[model samples]
Target: MTKEFLLECERKLAKSYVCTALGRDDDSIAITKEIAKDIAFEVTNSIHPISMETAPYVVAALRTLANGIEKEMNPLDKEIARALQELMGRFQFVKEEVKVDL
Candidate 1:
């Protein structure tokens, strides 16, 4: 995909890193989602007419990182896992969309 699109995907995925690092709560998850969505929009907007081959890798990396964070973010913190799951789901959806476009 285009570099701008990939960069935006990376930025959105990065928000997951911030969310997973925070304490468990709806507020934390909400903030993370907002940031991610905005970043995703910016990234998409930056794309131009270009043939892309490689699928975005940010979501996959975030998924891996989120899994790692879930393991260490206190097993008792169900909220954290739940939040991360939400983010992952959205990330995956976006990744799929980008792939479909390519």
Candidate 2:
């Protein structure tokens, strides 16, 4: 089940983020897959709609998690952290737009 989730994340990231840079780095790919899985799990399990105001909080939390992961001194994980940061930025934008439309 977790493998399926990671695969879905990989497909989503490839289609949406076009993370071509991750192709050469297996560790980065794995880290990105894990991040995507976490995001997917949150999205699936949450009941409340994600608001623009809440997006930053979510990103901060993820950043904290990424920071902990970075302690391992893996450069590939840093790339994944950067990508996750970018994803949060984009999510914030979309959430802001949705909030305005509501």
For lDDT, the strongest prediction is 2
Give the distance in Å from residue 22's predicted Cα in candidate 1 to where it truly belongs: 10
TM-score of 2: 0.36
For residues 2-102, write the lDDT of model 1, one tens digit per residue: 68766766675566566667754565556567665665556445442223443345446556865886777765676855755567556632323333342
User: How big is the positional error of residue 9 in model 1, measured in Å on the Cα after superposition?
Assistant: 15
Candidate 2 lDDT (Cα, 0 to 1): 0.60
> Candidate 2, residues 1-102: lDDT per residue as tens digits?
367876776676664444446455655555556666577556535524556767688778867965776898678867866777666554432222236454
Best by TM-score: 2
> Where is model 2 poorest over a 10-residue stretch in terms of lDDT?
89-98
Candidate 2: stretches off by over 4 Å = 11-64, 93-102
Give all candidate RMSDs, comma-separated. 9.4, 8.3
